[model samples]
Target: MIVQVALATGFVLILIGIYGALTQRNLLRMIVAFTVANSGVNLVIVAVGYLPGRTAPILDATVPAAEAAARIIDPVPQALVLTAIVIGLGVTALMLAFAYKLYEKRRSLDIARFSELKW
Candidate 1:
């Protein structure tokens, strides 16, 4: 039930991000929207790997080795999400830098006003 809610929330955030990215004119706003979408993708990935009654994939005296595979949540998706988050942060930073450069060159943040670069 909780996972369902999380997945729904993630999906909604992704849709909102897509809408914002598509409609916004400012480069900064578009970059922010992409970041939001990236976050939603991470949430969905984590939620998909979550198990309702499972514990973390850690060994202890309480949990026997034989049952560990069945009792613990899968860690691969979680690890992938973590990596993706770091990559997303780097991408967002790069986008922000590009936006800054664009603004510096054009003296405007609006994307529509920079059509002179066309080949």
Candidate 2:
């Protein structure tokens, strides 16, 4: 039940982010919406790794043998998410830089005013 709710909530967040990104004009807000979408996806992925009848993956000898035998959550996805987070930081930095340049070029943050390529 918890996992299902998490998945549903994540999907809703993704939808909201998509809508905001499509309809909003401010560059920074669009970036923030993208970040929200990314978070939703990450949450879904993490939720998928959760096991209801399983114990934590910590390898203490005190853990019961049967619980330890239950297939552990795949670590690869978690590692991938860590790498993605780092990459996302870079993407945000780049997007912020472009936003700053846009502000400098037009002295405004409105996206509608920069429709032309030459300006």
Candidate 3:
């Protein structure tokens, strides 16, 4: 029930972000929407990899090594999501930097105003 809700929320966020990114002509707004979409994707990945009633992949006195595989949740997706989050941050920073440079160059944030730069 909770997992379903999370998945639905993630999908909804993705759709909303995509819509915002596509419809907005402002560079900053589009970057913000892409970040929202990226977050939604990360949520979906985590939700899909989540296993109910499972513990983290840690072996202690209570959790024996032999039963670790069956008792613990998969860690791969979590790790991937962590890495993706860092990469996403870097990408967002780059996009912001580009936006700043473009603004400084043209004094405008509207993407349509920069169409002449197209090759």
| Number of the predicted model whose lDDT against the real structure is largest | 3
Colliding residue pairs in candidate 2: none
Candidate 3 C-alpha error for residue 65, in Å: 2.4
Q: How does each model score on lDDT? A: 0.91, 0.82, 0.94
What order do you get sorting by TM-score, best first? 3, 1, 2
What is the C-alpha lDDT profile of model 1 across 29-90, one tens digit per residue? 89889989988999999999999999887889877789998899989999999899999989
User: What does the lDDT read for residue 3 in candidate 2?
Assistant: 79
For every candidate in turn, the CA RMSD to the true structure comes to 1.9, 2.7, 1.8
Q: Model 2, 1-119: lDDT tens per residue?
A: 88799989989989999999999988889999999998888888877877766645666776655766664555666777778888988988999999999899999888898888845
Among all windows of 10 consecutive residues in model 1, the one with the lowest summed lDDT is 56-65
Off by over 4 Å in 3: 117-119
Per-prediction backbone clash count: 0, 0, 0
